[model samples]
Target chain A: MSSKNLIIVPIFNEAWNLPLLFERLGALKKSWDVLYINDGSSDSSKELLEAQGSNFIDLAYNIGIGGCVQTGLKYAFEHEYDYAVQLDGDGQHPIEALSELLEEVNSNECDIAIGSRFKRDKKHPVGRTRRLGIRILSSTIKVLTGQTILDPTSGYRLFNRKSISLLSENYPQDYPEPESVVFLLKNGLRICEVPVRMNSREGGISSIHRDGIFYMAKVMLSMIMVVLRPKESSHGSR
Target chain B: MEADNLVDINRVQYIAIAVSVVYLLAILYLIRGKKIREEYSLIWLLFGVVFIVLSIWREGLDWISNLLGVAYPPTAIFLIFFMAIFLIMIQFSLIISRLSRNNSKLAQDQALIKQKLEQVEKKLSEK
Candidate 1:
C-alpha cells in the first residue's frame, strides 16, 4: 500500500476463474493497485469485470498475451509506478510468493524477479513433454545469454521502473515468456528468480498445449531473433 | 520444316499476346475502380507490360534465354515469372507485418483512452 507497486493481470477468456483470482488478489497482505487488461474475451468476462467495479481495460480485440501484458506495463510506466508485477489470470502464480518478488525489487537485489516453479525442485504439474520443452528453452537461454534461468517459461514476474519502461515500448507478440527473458538480459537488465508453488490452471485450456510442437519451434526461433537483434541505443526511445 | 515451326511459334505468340492484353485491361479496370491501390497496382502493371513485350517480340525470349544460359526460352519465361512472384510475396509479408504491428498498437491505445475517459466521467459526476 505504501509502495508505488502495480500488479498487472492479463486476462483472455478465463471467465470461470475470474472470481477466484479476484478473491486471491483481494486477500493479499499489501493492497497494491491492480490493473486487469482484457484481451478481447468473447465470454462473460467483460460483464463480470464491469459488475465488480474493478479497474480494468477491455481491449477492442484480441491482441495475444504479449500485447495484453505490455498494455499493463504501459499503464504502470505512464502512472510512474515504482514496480510492476505480472500475474496470470489462470490462477497459477501464488499470491504468497509476491512479497518475495517485491522485496527483491524493493531492496535493489535485481531489476526483475521471476517467480519460478522449478528452481530447486524440477517438479512441475505439466506433462513430461511440455516439461522437456521448457527445459529446452531454458538451455537455449543459458547458452545464448550466459545466464542460467531455471524457469524461463514462468510468466510470474516483477519488473522495476527500468524494465517496465523498456518492456512497455517493446515486447514480444506470441509466446513471449522465454523470448522476453532473453530480451531483458540482452539489454543489461538483471533477472533473478524466487521459487514459488504454482497451482495447476483452474480454468481455460493452456495456450501452449493446443500447439505444443509448433509453439516450441516458434518460441525457440523468437529467442534466437532476440539474441540477434541489435541493442537499443536509448532505453525507451521510439 | 523450319517454316512449319515458325508458324507454330507465331501461333503461341498470338495467344500469349491476347492473354497479356486481357491481363493488362483487368489491372487497369481494378485501378480505375479504386479496388487496388495505385502503389500495389504498379507491380501488376509492370508485369502486364513485360508479358506483352515478350509475347510481341518473339526473338526477345530467345535472346534472354541465351543471355541467361537457359536451354529453353519457355523455361526462361517461367524463371522470370517465378522471380516476380517471389518478390511480390516478400512485399506482401512486409506489408502484413507492418499492419499487424500498427493494429496492436492501436488496440492498446484505444483501451487506455477508454479507461481514462471512464475515470474522467466518474470524477465529473461526483463533482
Candidate 2:
C-alpha cells in the first residue's frame, strides 16, 4: 500500500484568497488528503469551504495560529498519516515546494523539513526589519539548541510521524513558529531546511505586521522559555 | 495630648470597620446574585472576614506588629493586605493558566470530532 500523506491548511478569514488556494490544493488532492481547519472565520470562508465540499473542521472560536495548527497536527496524528505538511491559508507558502519537503523526510534525511525562504532563494524577500528579527531569532535558536535555522519564522513546514506525534502533544500556543524549532531540536529530533521561494500574502493582514516590535520581543522570550523547559525524558529510551 | 491620640486611633478604627463591612456586603451580594462562583468566592469571603476581625480587634493588630517587629501597628495592616492581594493574584494566575490550557484542548478535540462526524455522514449519505 502507498504511504498516506496529508496537507493541513489552517485558514482564518481568508475569503479573498481561498479560491486560488483551493485550486492549487486541488492538484495535489489525487495523491494527498487535504484537511482545511477553519479557525472560526467570520467571513465567507465557511460558506466557501462548504460550497466546494471541502473536508474541513470549523473551530468553535478563534484559537490563535498555534492552536489552529496543533488541531491539524492532532488530526494528522490520529489518522496515522506517514507524512504531514502545513500550508498557510494566506497564500504565502508555495504548494510546489511540498514535494521537495516531503522528499527530505521520506529519505530519512530529517524528521522535519522546513521550506526556507532565505537559504539561497531570494525570489521573495521580507522587509528589512522583519529580516533582522528573523536573524536574531535564528541566532537565539542556534545558541540554545545549536541548530542553525535560516528561516525560523517560515511557516512552510513538513513533518514525519515522529515529529507530528511530538508536536501534536505539546505545541506552543502564541507565536509558535520560532519557538517550535527550538522545541523540536531540544527533543532530540533533527530538523533541516530546504531553499524554496515563498509568495507574498495575497490578501489579509500578516500577524507580525500588526505588532512588529512587540511580536519580536514576545517570540524571543518564548524561545528562551522553551530552552529552559525540561526535555522529554523519553528521548533516551526511544 | 494623650486623649487626642486615642481619638485619632478610634477614627482610624472606625474607617477600617466601615470599609470592611462594605467589602463584605459586596461579596455577599455577588454570591447571592451568582455573579461569583462559590469556589472562587470563598477566598474573597475569607479575606473579608479576616479584614473585619483585624479591624475590630485592635490588640490583634498590635500583637501581629509586635511579632513582626514593625515600628507601627498600622504597618501590620498594610503587610497583611499586601500579602492577601499577592496570594489572590497568584491564585488568579493559576486559574487563568488552567483555563487557557483547557480551552485550547477543547477546541482541538471539538474540531477533530466535527471532522470525523462529517466524514461519517458523507459516507452514510453516499450509501
Candidate 3:
C-alpha cells in the first residue's frame, strides 16, 4: 500500500508532449510504474507509445477522456496496484506537485486527491467559456452530492485502492469528472482537491476548443446526465 | 388462465378488435424508421402489418378460426404472439451470424501474427 507503486496517464493525439512527459515520468520511474492509456491517437502517438517501450494499454478507438481514464484505472485494478494517478497527456497538469499528491494519499490525508486550479495557487487557462461552464457544472455537482468541489473537471487526481476499485468496476462513460466526484462521495470515500498549476496546451487543438461555445453547453449538460443518473442496480462484473 | 375463464367469452370479439387495432398502430409507428431506410426493424414491422390486416379482416379470421375449431379473437391474438416470437428468433440468428464472421476473422489474424513473430525469432537467432 505504498504510494510509489503505479500511476496511469491517459494521452490522445498528444505527440509533442509525450517526449517531455516521458522525461518527467522517467524521473519518477524508480518506484512508480507509468501506464499510458492511448485513446486512438491517429498521429505518431501509437508509434511513440510502441517505441517508448513502457507499460501501456491501447483502447480500440477514440472513446474520449472518460474512456481513456477508465482504461488506466481498469488496468491498475486488475493488476492490483497500490495507487493510481491520472496524468493528463496534454501537459496541463503540473507533474512537479506529484509528490505532494502522493503523500496525501499514502498518509490517508485523502482517499483521493484532485488537483484544483480554482484555489489561486495555480495558473489556469483564461477562457470565459471553460470557466463559466466548469462553474455551472461544479454548482450542480454540489447540489447533487452536498459537497462543493473546487475543481470538478480537473484531470489531475491520485486514487487509492478503494477509489480505483469502484471506478474500474463502473466508471462514467461520458464527461466523467463531476460524476466521479459525486459517485465517490455517495459511496463514502474521502475526496478533496489541492491547488496545482495547470499550464496551457503544448501543441495541437483540444477537442473541447474545436467545438467552442456549442461544446461548452453540450458538455455541461452531458456531465449532469452522467452524474445524476440513478446508479445501476446490477452488481458484480458489468 | 383462471382470469380468462371468469370473463364472458361472447364479449371477446368486441375487446379483441380494440386491443389488436391499438397494437397494430404501435407497431406501425415503430416501423416509421424502417420506411426511411432499409432497417433490421423491418422484419418485426412486416410481421406486425400482416397481423394487423389479418385481425381486422373479420371474415377471413372467422373462417380460419372455424377451421381451427377455436374462437376467432383468441386465434388472431395467439397468431400475433407467435409472429412476435418468430421475429425475435430471426434477430438472434442475425447476431449469431455476425459473431461467427468476427470470430473467424480474428482467428485468421492471430495465426498470421504468430507466423510473423516466429519468422522474426528465427532471423534473430541466425544473427
Most DockQ-accurate candidate: 1
TM-score of chain B, candidate 2? 0.87
Cα error of candidate 3 at position A80, Å: 1.4
In model 3, the runs with Cα more than 4 Å from the true position are A205-208, A212-238, B1-127
The sequence of per-residue lDDT tens digits that candidate 1 reaches over residues A1-238 is 4778899999888789899888988887655899998999998988989888999998999999999999999999999998899999988888888888988777766899999878757655668777888889889998999999988888899999999989999999988899999999999999988888888777666657778889998999999998898986676675
Ranking of models by TM-score: 1, 2, 3
- What TM-score does prediction 1 earn? 0.94
Clashes per candidate, residues 3 or more apart or on different chains? 0, 0, 0
Rank ordering of all candidates by lDDT, starting from the highest: 1, 2, 3
Best candidate, lDDT-wise? 1
TM-score winner among the candidates? 1
TM-score of model number 3: 0.64
- CAPRI-style grade of the A/B interface in model 2: high
Q: Summarize candidate 2's per-residue lDDT along A1-238 as a digit string, tens digits.
A: 6778999999899988899988989877477899999999999999999999998988999998899999999999899988888999999888988888988776767999999988875645688777778888889888998879999888899999899888888888988899899989998999889888888768765556778888888998988988888887652332
TM-score of each: 0.94, 0.90, 0.64
DockQ of each: 0.86, 0.80, 0.04
lDDT by residue for model 2 (B2-117), tens: 77766765887899899999999999999999999989989999999999999899899889999999989888889988999999999999999899989988988988898899
**Per-candidate TM-score, chain A:** 0.95, 0.94, 0.86
- Superposed by TM-score, candidate 3 places the C-alpha of residue A51 at a distance from the truth, in angstroms, of 2.0
Clashing pairs in 3: none
